[model samples]
Target: MVQKETFGEVIRKLREESGLPLRKVAAHLDIDPSTLGKIERNERTANKEMIEKFAEIFSTNSKTLLVSYLSDKVAYEIMDEDCTKDILKVAEEKIKYYKKVKKLIVMPTKTKIKPYKEIDSDVLTLAEEEAYQLRIGENPDDIDLDVIDKINVWDKSVKVEENGYYWKGEPYITKGKLPANDKPLVVELFCGCGGTSLGFELAGFEIAIGCDIHQPSINTFKTNHPNVSTVLGDVRKVNPKSFLQLLDGRQVDVLIGGVPCQGFSLNNRKRHENE
Candidate 1:
């Protein structure tokens, strides 16, 4: 059987096929030839920008190239772990679900009306009171009235399912009305299980999107907030523009992230302050 080629191997093969020397390509990318060589040998990792530069040089799809590079990095990082295969399986499932949800949200349909008596009156009343307060001083056009409309939709009790996930309980609506002129929008990076997103939502912020590499964590997040868009992939592999695309022209009020901190955690087996 032929061995699988790594991202490094693919890059090296392309460079050799194009008859470009390491020094020449490195000069064009403004990186040292030694650094480029290490990257090709898998001794060093390339950032997203560097990978994009490589894609340009090789005339390849930047997203595909970045995914390959990130896959290699993830593999290397978890090589010594016993649950690597399980983790990857979960990641794949989560990514698949994320794509499905993204498609559904991008093209939503009108939800059918149901009897108001069957709905949760407490939540509906709260939503109505909040909406009234917000509209008291602001023009209707200035506010995202769609948010209130969403609350009204939730006034009907119905089971909803999307992309294999099901919900029949109270709708996961924001606790209060967002500001008429400035609804705070957040983009969360490394958003594990969406704890921060939940907090922000409770504080009346719109969670524009969230991203995480781990599959199980993202699955939990999706289960809780099915309406929020999420990306299941390595943050290093994702382009900044991709996050903007999720916003769909909405301005981001906050950008939050909780990067890997296992090495610094007190419970870590190999804890190090300098890490």
Candidate 2:
């Protein structure tokens, strides 16, 4: 089973279930049979190329294997540490911040996104005191923390199974009685957990509906935007007339969303520069 299985265990299960022996996949990975066996037995790690090769040989989604491997790596790093969850929370924020900056900004300016842990205190102090006077007017507070709306495009967002708390964004804690402003009717496609939509709502927009192909995401979205309509399936097959009917004669303000970018998503696929 994929659930709760270590990376090694998952790979082993996949191979065994498919009735493929150890040497078959190992040959595909171009590694020795013993090494691949070690990988299956959790005695060794698999490289990115090996992970990619596994997907090819097994005819499986590369993302599934990649996700398992990355998560396993994280687990190993934090296995014996106290407050591992706390470390993960901070790491999540950092991942979002770094990814956001890399994808949308910094590329054109030749700006390098360095981790705060690497920066000297003196440099940070100077940045706090004098960065604003040089060009853009902003203090430590402005730069240290970010706008909620901007940060909402995180790699990970709120995930709740049932009657759970809203871990982030508006409708926080519970989807209590929401007073709406007469703003534009917002509908998001592939909206996961309603993070960005919630930002829009907080900025006074009325969220009308959210649709995604993921069941868990729809579950989360329904929890947050309790009043909003949600569709869960291939939106391509959905009848436009029926989709509009959900709007109930109200005009939509804007439609926005992008499909998953393989390398920079929750799966967070990593590869060698040469690969």
Candidate 3:
């Protein structure tokens, strides 16, 4: 069986193999060196898109890179011992199912574990557990109920307390006109739910192509942007040449994206230190 590695270990391994200094890699990717440094240290999780970028820069596969991390190993082992193996196994299966079905799949819960009569009665899932754990909160780690329900509970509780929502229901819009003869064009990366793409449309840009790793989000995007082409895979795995090919003879005016945000959270405080 392939052993799992941590985020830090993989970053260090890739850096060493690339024969490039940290600054050089960061400069090439337009990332701050200190941010890259902390990712190597496993203090934070890189978002899906960024992990793909790292894989591309280092000439490695994301799955191969992810499984080599020690932290992932530790986390898996802990989950297994805590009887959450079934949840992870199921989640992996669901992801596979989505790929095979070529449709959007949503896993809102893990194994169905009912709450005690003396406690709350709700169900949850493994993905939900991880989401709850990753959030900023003051809850003790408890896996009695389903992880998904716990996350919902957390979300609802937070919403009630803050009287806030994560995103505005309304979208931004702009108006413009392109030449009738101008070729329709779009370049999208980390294209989650096509929010950025919508923004481009508001500005009168026609989307020709888009890419993202999340099958569900991509499926939703495809439904909303039926005329646009989409690639259901990591952007890093996409060959730059292939990306160029999608545009054919047309020139792209705007590149839209929501590249990994988690990586920046690690060293955002130190961003101005060297300045």
Candidate 4:
């Protein structure tokens, strides 16, 4: 059997077979040599633009290279666990069912639109399985019930206390100090509802503060993480001096942000509107 090569391995093999130096290829791709090396070694993930450049430089089919790149991403993410195969199998079935439903809705057929309560049990099972997979992926050992509970809370009105944070009615409270963390402080900008901040906190980083323009999002974030200060207002209009004041002379080890994706996202209401 021919051994299947990973995306990075294929890239490296193609480059070497073409007698192109790493530095030369990196320069052509307009990326740092170290970054290219990391990509070839599978230590780094390649973005769509980088993959496109690689495909162009190597004179390979872009779609084929893209598939390889995406496959590598899924492989690395799941780490090829036995459970992942089952999850993917169910996911594929769900996709097929969804497509069939969509076709029925769009094809002017006599098929009745199924209400939520009337949906197939198999669909519900698929959804539940997918959710379980996501939860397991995040908390492998099925630990951290607090985080899990908070994640399942769809209503903002419901109050739950866990891990040092308490949500009562509106504002939350920190029952104790931030777990005596010595890790570097992180400041998250455009932090909608604190999902990313929660991940960082779980990874042992102390989140000093977060900022966002949406009031409801800020409220949810504050309610979840009362220990971390939250600022509400347009990020562009917020003064840099204010951030320094929030830092209180402490060094900001890392700053993270997810810039608004509405303009670029296909699901956005104004996606087709010109900037």
Best by lDDT: 4
RMSD to true structure for each model, in Å: 24.3, 22.3, 21.8, 14.0
Which regions of candidate 2 fall more than 4 Å away from where they truly are? 104-275
lDDT, candidate 2, 170-242, per-residue tens: 2211122323555788878878889989998898888877777666787888888888887776666566776
Q: Which scores greater on TM-score, model 3 or model 4?
A: 4
Off by over 4 Å in 4: 47-56, 59-67, 70-215, 223-226, 231-275
Model 1, 1-275: lDDT tens per residue? Answer: 43367887878988999899999889878999998898789787777788878888888888878778787878888889999989999989988865654443322124632222222345435644444344343333565657855652222254333323322232222222223346699888878899999899899888878777666777887887777777777666666777666676678999999887855564443333443
TM-score of each: 0.35, 0.39, 0.32, 0.40
- Give the distance in Å from residue 214's predicted Cα in candidate 2 to where it truly belongs: 62
lDDT of residue 70 for candidate 4: 79
List of clashing residue pairs for candidate 1: none
TM-score of 1: 0.35
Error of 4 at 184 (Å): 10
Which run of 10 residues does model 3 get worst, by summed lDDT?
166-175
Q: After superposition, how far is residue 27 of candidate 4 from its true place, in Å?
A: 2.9
Candidate 4, residues 13-56, lDDT tens digits: the string is: 98998889999999988889999899899898877787788888
Q: What C-alpha lDDT, on a 0 to 100 scale, does residue 270 get in candidate 3?
A: 21
| Ranking according to TM-score, highest score first | 4, 2, 1, 3
- Model 2 TM: 0.39
Report every candidate's CA lDDT: 0.69, 0.68, 0.60, 0.70
